[model samples]
Target: MSFYHTPKALSAFDAKFEAQKIAFGPISFQVAHCLLKFEVLATIDQAGEQGLSIAQLAQTNVLNEYALGVLLDMGLSMGLVWLNGDAYVLDKTGYFLLHDDMAAINLNFVQDVCYQGLFQLDKALVAGKPSGLAVFGDWQTIYPALKDLPAEAKASWFAFDHYYSDHAFPQILPLVFAHSPKHLVDIGGNTGKWALSCCEFNPEVEVTLMDFPGQLAVAKDNATKHGFAERIHTFATDLLDESRPFVEGADTYWMSQFLDCFSQEQILSILQRTAQAMTPNSQLFIVETFWDRQPSAASAYCVNATSLYFTAMANGNSRMYHSKDLIKLLHQAGLYVDEDTDNLGLGHTLLRCKRKP
Candidate 1:
């Protein structure tokens, strides 16, 4: 009973734990890398119960069997595989990695983008900007390079970006549509992913997506795929510029996974313009990750890394503003915070505001 009160011992334990984590960091990185590379789990899924040998796996995926063996051995150490007499089989944890089940969320996106992006962490820290942008110069400028990426890689990026709303939106829909907005505008709505989700959930709602010309095409394709082409409209515009065309008579203006890609001045300006375009009864909803007054280690890492990534790649950053700071920003634009819902998923929060109604 008294051992718990030993502060010195506890501090020593924490130090040791941190040291261990630092030492084992590369293990974590490699395990994830190997998993994605081998498509071990995915391969198993495709091949069914028939396990593949290292040679078979290598030939099938066009990989070097010797190099893959090293990685697979590492994975076995991490308990992700079972080495059963020369044949490799997916263990319980490894099985999930292959299938697009619950754990699909983890393997698909974060591992592909965030993991790879971390290589430039030092550069991001030094430059005070996202490593992607720092390395690539601009977000739009990098797409041309990615055009030749394999389909799996592209799908991984899409999965990661869509992780914000994939399955978490339904839980927050009640809180989101409590005010029952009719006409909705999604600014910087990439591919209309969120807009489609909102429209699907709220059948009576009409959504207009405003984004760049390149992205509008993707959004249009998404709308068509969702059979909401008639209900969803697309407009191309630069949201940062003063000459941007605005959405009018909208009961709700939604920015999902948006708004973090700017300076405070830019955010205020955008909000002010949005306020001007809204009716007195209109509402604005911003869904984003929030940093607590004293953020946890995981939250801090995610927010800081994401901020750097966006800044470097897209000229954007993630701001984990507190509730009061959010209110202040809204008020600066003549809008007021009406309500907020926390813990949407991970460290995310939703701030629902209106035109000082």
Candidate 2:
């Protein structure tokens, strides 16, 4: 006999499918802004026993309460806040979102930067160029606009720097330091976050961070704050320019989250230049995300979304390049892969290679 569903079972399945379809529609900005605005308010709420009134919240320096009430109403609907008559209070989600001590506090970076950048995703894909560059002229424009902002705003961006380092260092550093390298170079190192982490992990390692002038200034300050001023040095350089400096005799080179920012040809040129700077025994460690041997649905979805966002905002693209692809690139640059590690948490992978001896 044929296996056919009963009419009642088929109706129930169809109903569930329709419900899911409705639930999965695009997330509205009204809803998104509610979550973000709640974070700022929740932070204020925790500072004192009594939460600020709506009028007080509106006039607060961190945020304008009148503009924020629109969001607060939405938050109430989302169960992120509780309304005791006219008094508004934070709920469980609000407290967790406002917790600054957690590494995940960096979620605001996504809401503030990525969300706005991705708003023009459809136009970006059709034009086949970065909307951010086209809209704002260059990557540097965004920095100056944000440079003078409050510390909270600055911290949002810095949190991303911290997040990247926290996820990448643990897996890659142990293997690199095992060789007892004396000096290392971090190309395009932003704010020296990764370099500081490296120095913290291996006290013997001295680091040279190379980046743009503005980024170097920030990195210098960060290095000082982290007590790595003497050990970590900053220099302004363009990795893409022919005049780029490669500190000769360095034992290791780190290119974390750098390669994906360029085209294939550009990456090849960068790798070649880096190889020329390395001694025969020198090593290179690359920390990035790539597809798993068998990727799950969630992983694939994340990769696709990130690739699209990067392309739109920065004219950059991320791919899950296999070990063979990396080896081929290294070989073209006259280097060889010595070790490889995958699934380094936070969707990162590490490739350790050495200059051809």
RMSD of each: 5.6, 7.3
Error at 211, model 1, angstroms = 1.0
Q: How much is 302 displaced in model 2, in angstroms?
A: 3.0
Ten contiguous residues with the weakest lDDT in model 2: 1-10
Supply the global lDDT for candidate 2.
0.67
Off by over 4 Å in 1: 1-14, 35-111, 114-117, 126-150, 293-305, 311-316, 319-324, 345-347
Residue 225 displacement in candidate 1 (angstroms): 4.5
Tell me the tens digit of each residue's lDDT in model 1 across 1-357.
112234544577889977886788767556755666667656754554556678878877756887778777876766667776677777776665655443565455445445565667676657655565333234443344344445665676566667666655777677777889788899888778778887888888888998777888988988898899888998788887987769887888988777766667788888989999999888888887755522365555556555554544444344555456666788989988777777776556788888875
Can you list the residue pairs that collide in candidate 2? 58-65, 291-320
Instruction: Please estimate how well model 1 matches the true structure, expressed as its whole-model Cα lDDT.
Output: 0.69
Candidate 1 residue 329 C-alpha distance from true site, Å: 1.9
Q: Please give the CA lDDT of all the candidate structures.
A: 0.69, 0.67
Candidate No. with top lDDT: 1
lDDT of 2 at 157: 59
